[model samples]
Target: MYEFFRDLDRRWIFLMMFLCVAVPIIIIGATGKTFPEEPTQLVRAVFDEIENLPSGSKVLLSYDYDPASEGELAPMATMFAYHCAAKGHKMYFMALWPVGPQMVDDTIENIIKKDFKDLKYGEDYVNLGYKSGYEGVIKVIITDFTELYSTDTRGTPWSAIPMCHDVNSVQDMDLIVNVSAGYAGTKEWVQYAVTPYPKLRMVAGCTGVQAPLLYPYIPQQLHGLLGAIKGAAEYEALVIEAYGDKMARKDAGDNPLTDDNGDYLIPGKYTEGIRRMGPQLVAHLLMILLIIVGNVIYFVERRREGRR
Candidate 1:
């Protein structure tokens, strides 16, 4: 066994790694099954901040990422919309990045339009659309929203939109939820909007690389934070466990259908983060195993050379 493994071609190792990742993804895609996730304190904080809010509370959802970071950012963004809509919060969607409006549109289409069809636009929610000037936009809107944003994305004036009628600035919002990739994102919101006002509450979802930098503001300027796909998966699990029909049925003393793996059936849209995590988890394990085996082989070879 040692001899064969010692002489194993690099191609074989590559093949094993490929199978490690590909097999899980294919199985998950086919089965609609995902591994369970235990949400951390940070993720739970994000969920709670939204969950605890009173229904009809105004929430500013600032999606500041473009398509380039969509895979990492979109899942949480979708969940943020789903959770807010589920709670009957009045969503105010806006963007800092030029492409952010499209991201906002995608979330609105996928989660709100598809799932919460009864929600009326302008009253239940409104798209304030993208504004240039990055943090400058934040600075202005924090004081007088109409100074920078006088209309919704559809060109309807703010005075015309029922939700905007009472909303004068970010200060009027019950909570601010930000999905960000870089500058003019969570950090800027914290520094400009939350810090000075101190009355304004905020939470954020950001890329893995940006998570650490924003951690210091948590439970203070930022109520909670979700970092990267893992954070998204954990938050998804919490949301699904809370609101998914299968879990509801199970709680109601009915038997809920489960997959062969005993995992509860979940909608494909809500499982993006979990499905993506499957390949990553398997590949990481494979890498770990390879490192251990290579170390064992190196030590064994050193012993043999010493004996000779």
Candidate 2:
């Protein structure tokens, strides 16, 4: 039995990990209980800022993710949009990645339009689409938004978009909410937008791998951060608690799951980060147990040889 267990193929371990992830996901989907997540200061700060904002405040959402991080970053993006819309904040949506515009469009379709349908385009919110210059665009926008994105996704001049008509520069925004994956993301936004302007408030959400790297800038250049899916889940919980109940009373018989807090349980949206944690925790335990057993086997063999 020892030898059989010792010779167990790695594929067996992989199967076990798969089951650990797959099973919980199935159960969670049926029952909305995601492993209890406690929102850290960073998560709470992000939610608090939006909640405290005066209605119709100008908020810029920089979608710096591509299809690669869409799974992790998209949830927060949707949540940020919902939070801003819920506050009646005028949203100025734009993206740094070429595909980012599509992501913004998808979130609007899924979370915004489905719920905040009454928000008139060019008034309550405007999608500035995407631009190509990376950090260079940020440098330009820090001074002027129109010179870079002269027109909206619909090709109407910036002047035509009532929500954005008065906003001439990034400084005009009440907050810069940056959702990023890798390069040309929060780092770039911090370097070009938030860093120079002492008053340019910013909050961001990045994948777990990128979180550590951005730590030094937090609570300074970045007012707050949402780290990976866990961060998203944490922030989502905060949103649900603060806004979900309020929305429930007003939305009257409306499906809370569709646009309200229920959007946090978004199918496949929260999967990557939340689902990943289960396997990661199991894999870590398996590796630790393997190490301890290996050490025992080595010491036992050494003692047996000495006895002989």
Candidate 3:
């Protein structure tokens, strides 16, 4: 019996883990059992900032992630675009990483292109694609965007972009959102964009590994943060609750859905982040149980040795 359990193939454990995650994902996909997320203070702050803002506010969305974080960060970023688009805000898109451009493009393709087709190019929003300089780009963009990106991604001059005309730098915006993955992301935005320009309100959605380091800056420097898939889930809940109504207004051009008005009916691709949380919660629970069982086994063996 000891060997039966103790010498279990490593593949079995792996299979268990795979099923633990896979089952929840499939269940959620079919049943759509999303755990209710009560917005934390940080998440509330992010939601409220957008809520309180008047329509047509200028929002700078800086994509600071690569492919590595597209799973966790992409959903939040897409929702960020969705929320801003729903609110009728002008989104100025830019990226810091080389691959960041692709992430930015994903949002444009998925959210802006499909949902917000009414939004015009170079007028309602602009995409200033990735720049090589890390913090240097931030330093320059704090004062003048034209210094770094003289032309938009299409090789059009900044002056040609209706949204880019009066937009001098990060300071010109009402609020800034830096969706980051690593070193050149939210930290750089906070330091160069928010630190010097105190008036600039900034929020971030970063990867799980990097979330703890950013806690120190919370509420003060960063207005809100979406930390990993959990953060994305929370933000996803917020957006769904608040703006899910818009899907009901879908006209002939909209994506086909069974019940566009009902919850989970529209089925925006942003749900990926929230869906991941189901597996994460179950996996963490399994780990906790395993740890307790391990401790029990250790303590039992220790007592038996003492008797010998």
Candidate 3 lDDT score at position 62: 92
Show the lowest summed lDDT stretch of 10 residues, model 1. 246-255
What Cα-based lDDT does every candidate model obtain? Answer: 0.90, 0.81, 0.83
Angstrom error at residue 29, model 1? 1.1
Off-target runs (Cα >4 Å) in candidate 1 are 1-20, 246-264, 286-308
* TM-scores for candidates 1 onward, in order: 0.85, 0.84, 0.91
Ranking by lDDT: 1, 3, 2
Best of the two (1, 2) by lDDT: 1
Best by lDDT, which number?
A: 1
In model 3, residue pairs whose N, Cα or C atoms come closer than 3 Å (at least 3 residues apart or on different chains), thus clashing, are: none
Q: Which window of 10 residues has the lowest lDDT sum in candidate 3?
A: 255-264
Positional deviation of residue 218's Cα in model 1 after best superposition, in angstroms: 1.8
lDDT, candidate 2, 100-173, per-residue tens: 99988998887678778899888888899999899999999899987889999999998877777688899999
Q: Roughly what TM-score does model 1 have, to 2 decimal places?
A: 0.85
Q: Kindly report which residue pairs in candidate 1 clash with one another.
A: none
Q: Comparing 1 and 3 by TM-score, which wins?
A: 3
